[model samples]
Target: MAIVALRAPLKDLAGGRSEVKVDGASVIDVLRALEAEHPRIVGWILDEQGRIRRHVNVFVNGELTREDAPLSADDRVQVLHSITGGTA
Candidate 1:
C-alpha cells in the first residue's frame, strides 16, 4: 500500500486526514482507491473523464508524476491543489 498525503481542501474533504493508505500499482489506481474511501474527494482529484485536473498536481516519492505512473508498496503520493488568485 502507498501512503497518500492530502493537502489543504483535499485533506479537509478526506475527513481531516493528512495521509491515507491505499493499494494500487499506479497513481490513478491509488486515486481511485482514495475516492472509494472518501467519496467527497471524487471530482477534486479526478475529472469527469477520469483524468487528473489541470489545477491539481500529483507527486510520487516527492517527484511530480502523471496519473499512469507506476508505484511501489512503500511509495508516497502527494495530492495538492494549486492556489490561484487575481490582483485587485
Candidate 2:
C-alpha cells in the first residue's frame, strides 16, 4: 500500500483526511482505490478520460510523476492543486 497525501480541497473532499492508505501498483491504481473509498473525489483528480487533470499535480517521493508511474508499499504520493494566476 502507498501513502497518499491529499492537499487543500482534495483533502476536504476526502472527509477531511490528510492522508490515506491505498493499495495499487501504479499511480492510477492508487487513485482508483482512493476513488473507491471517496466517490466525491472522482473528477477532482482524474478527468473523464481517466487522465490526471492539468490543474492537479501529483508527486511520488517528492518528485513529479505521471499517472503510469510505478509504486511500492513504502512509496509516498502527494496530490496537490496547482495555483494559477494572471496579471491584471
Error of 1 at 24 (Å): 0.5
Model 2: ten consecutive residues of lowest lDDT: 79-88
Candidate 1 ranges with C-alpha deviation above 4 Å: 83-88
lDDT of 1: 0.91
- Residue lDDT tens for model 1, 40-84: 999988999989998788999989999899999989999876564
Q: List clash counts for every candidate, in order.
A: 0, 0
Clashing pairs in 1: none
**Could you list the CA RMSD of all candidates, in the order they appear?**
1.8, 1.8
- Give residue 24's error in model 2 in angstroms: 0.2
User: Which residue ranges in model 2 land beyond 4 Å of their true spot?
Assistant: 85-88
Cα TM-score per model: 0.91, 0.92
Lowest lDDT 10-residue stretch of candidate 1:
79-88
